[model samples]
Target: MDVSKVRKDFHILEKRVRGKPIIYFDSACMALKPKQVIDAVNSYYNDFTACHGRSVHYFSAQTTEKYIEAHRKVERFIGAKENEVVFTKNCTEAINLVANGLKWEKGDRVITTKMEHNSNLIPWMKLAKERGVVHDYVEVDNEGKLDIEDLNAKLETKTKLVSLVYTSNVTGATLNASEVAKICHDAGAMLLLDGAQAVPHMKVDVKKTGVDFLAFSGHKMLGPSGTGALYGRLDLLKGMNQFIVGGETVKNTMLSSWEAEDSPAKFEAGLQDYAGMLGFGAAADYLMRLGMEEVHSYEKKLARKLYDGLKAIPQVTNIYGPSNPEERSALASFTLKGMNPQEVALILDESANIFVRSGMHCCHLYHQDVIHEMHGTIRPSLYIYNTDEELDKFFDALRNIAALA
Candidate 1:
């Protein structure tokens, strides 16, 4: 998709550290901003410089109009209706909003996987603690793939929901959403997907996937931080109770009581992130222009090179997730023999000016259960801005480091 030309859109790519140009492989944790998104964020402060909703001045009017338009932009990007989207602080908040919106009973059950990020795992754990709700975790195999047959056996009539990761941040594994959705529906349970990792790199349609709810962070998808969204079914949202409520969430209020607004507004309580939403919409538009199919194809090619390249190194050991590029995202986690992950990451940056992530990648349960290492593995995740030349540099640097080990 003309990635060489696309690289110019990111000004940070030009920065040099020590003597070498920055080779960013940390897109999984947070993607770098493009100039287009940066400009959109600046437009609010530069052009409007006012609050959204309840204000009728020129700047306020412009802000409200653009703010609503941002929702439409994000909605269209995910194939959702006008008001089906709820803005939040991050994917953690988005998942929490969904988790709290539902009615929890003593025996109500939620089935999730062991490989989930803390954002997905912790909320359900909280539910189990506060309420008498039962949360069951489906196990992953040695390769980090969830056992589908085991998941099917676990589903029951009492299971209220099934939450799963669309793609693992540490393992680089992408689950079969359609298959998971079908089992939950057959068991009379709803499905929620943690889409923080998948939404940025691939095409995801809420209606097509049949998932009732999807949570994702804007920062992971080239948008500003403190911006995220929840895409929920209209029927489900209407039935579900709003978790957070405050300013502009209601039509009327009295000392006696207050009636909340419907759907999105009811879910969104306080003043929103106006500039971040504009940037988030801009990020979605940028990806739309690039076309997700092209992004997916390019990443698959990159993943193959990343997986195979890591495997060829003599001292490299224990690559996480599936070796098949088709079964995973454009990220890999591996530990060097006799070397710690943090030291490995530090050496790469110091010696080669490479930026990579180390540590559990926020999946502690996965580490305790599957890979069996709390120290985690060196991870280099790719995005559209990454180039083949950069990967070659990474591989050469890694080979040198492995020789030292």
Candidate 2:
């Protein structure tokens, strides 16, 4: 792949910030949109801006077609069936849809790991507390990788669901979903993955993993914000209750009697973000054209380079996952000794024109167990758009910051 040509597709990379070129390394939080995705969204608004699934008029039909086509794109991207994918506001909402929609009874157990983001953690935690269900956490080693032995031990007879983050947003630790799913199935528990950080940077085969459900956001995958999906097995979706019920989710209604729609449409309860959904389709197509294999390889090279460089700096404190780059995503989280992560991030932004994320990254419980300071870790997440040259600049800035310390 032509690196320069790929960079040109993102118009944001062409601009300068504070008279210096912007070096964005926060793609894990949200990826910069490409021109193709932008154009797709723009065209939707310009041509058809009507209510979907409501009317039989031309614009409404076009809107409905585009919205349903986006569902197909999401299904293809994640190796799920069209009826299995349910659109949500973001990954948080998608996770919540599963966590809350499921039939939870007293003595039921839900297992997750300490490495999970709050999106995956809090929803289950709330369910455990409110529904009198038991929640167990499979603790990770200091290296930020899950202890499979501990996980297996926790899979007791009562284990009802096993939620996991396929890739950590903080440490970039990638989990083996296939193995995890097998273990969960052996215990007769359903496996639901938080793919918010994994889907964009890695290749995901939900069928091969044998997971029963999965959720991911499109903003992190180069699409517009406020768009995400939840993939649930057809039978499971059929069994679960619809959390949100309104206009588009009902099949037929009377004053006191109403029938629910089919699997996905029943779950999607409101007038949807049609433009954003279509743009998500374009984003999926964009990544598919670039090839997920190439994206993974390119990102691994950059991750290892960043890891090695950070290790050489004495004042920089690195918190990484597995030792192998092939086992992780391009993102990394670290902190400068004696410096607040937010303070360091501010200095880098003001002095070096580099953008990075700082603080708990909404994974406070995980960081509280790992780092001394409970607030969070400074996260520098890389992506296909970021080049090695920008990473070098980041290293130079860190080195200079170390001198100040």
Candidate 3:
């Protein structure tokens, strides 16, 4: 994949910390933006800093054109129709669109997994609390792999939806979306995939998976923040209710009566992030040019290197993820014996200029209920721009920390 050349595209990689070269290993939280994405966002503010789809002036027209083009680019990126894509502030909002938009009757059931991030879990729990809807979770094995039998057992005729994470943010274990989708559909339930971790690291085709809805953020994929999308089947979206109201979301409004726009526009309300959308489209284009399959292959190679390196260290204990590199994403989460996760993370940053995530990673329920780790695990996430030398440095830092313990 010529990672050295790829590294040149990101300006943030050149940054230094405490007079030493910075080693970034926290792509799961937010990926570093490339110059192409930065330029695309800058051009929007520089040339056409105007409201989209609200005026007929030159700036507005240009902004509107780019905005619609961004939708088209994302549609192509995820193998969805243009009308099916709805832009949201982030992935959390995208998921909430489906959560709040759907009509939930009392006793209606929704199924999820323990491995989901808080963004995916909290909304459904809110539904259960405020409304009369029921929410259930599928079980995962010790390796953080979902139990298909438990998922099947949870599905019932009253099951309204099965929402799950495509990849675990903490453990890096990936779900078989197609299989899960089939199970949900067979039981007369719709499937929604939280693709925040999966979309950035792998090729995801919602059509191939037959999922009713998909949500992901652009910030985790080398794009700007406040940019994300929701892809829903046209038929399903047409039947759902609008989440937010006012502005472009409505077709016509009389004193007390209003008609909402169709599909995508019906969901998007108020002024959108025009600049962020352009950057998101550019980020998708960058990944497409490089090829998603190639990106996935390269990341898996690096993940295996990191996993094996961590395993070799005697102080490293309770490594949490799939043992097989092919079954996991480009990250690993583990805990060092006799050291707090936060302390280890601080040491790595202070001594080696390394950046990583430490904590439950917003999966507190999973950490307490499933893994049973109170403090949490040290997570080192990777991307295409990362190199082998960086992994070597990470291992060296860990070894030094281990000696002190």
Residue-by-residue lDDT tens digits, candidate 3, 135-226 = 99889888888899998899999999999888989889888889989988999999999999999988999898899999999999998988
Each candidate's TM vs. the true structure? 0.98, 0.98, 0.99
Q: How many Å off is the CA of 350 in candidate 3?
A: 0.6
For every model shown, the clashing-pair count is: 0, 0, 0
Candidate 2 lDDT for residue 365:
80
Q: 313-358, model 2: which lDDT tens digit per residue? A: 8887765677776676687888888888898998999999899999
The order by descending TM-score is: 3, 1, 2
Candidate 3 local Cα displacement, residue 226, angstroms: 1.8
Which digits, one per residue and each the tens of the lDDT, describe model 1 over residues 17-96? 89668999999898999999999999999999788887899999999999899899999989998899988889999999
Worst lDDT run of 10 residues, candidate 3, spans 321-330
Model 1, runs deviating above 4 Å: none
Angstrom error at residue 232, model 2: 0.8
Weakest lDDT window of 10 consecutive positions for candidate 2: 368-377
Model 1: worst 10 consecutive residues (lDDT sum): 320-329
Superposed Cα RMSD, model 1: 1.0
What is the Å distance of residue 114 in model 3 from its true position?
1.7
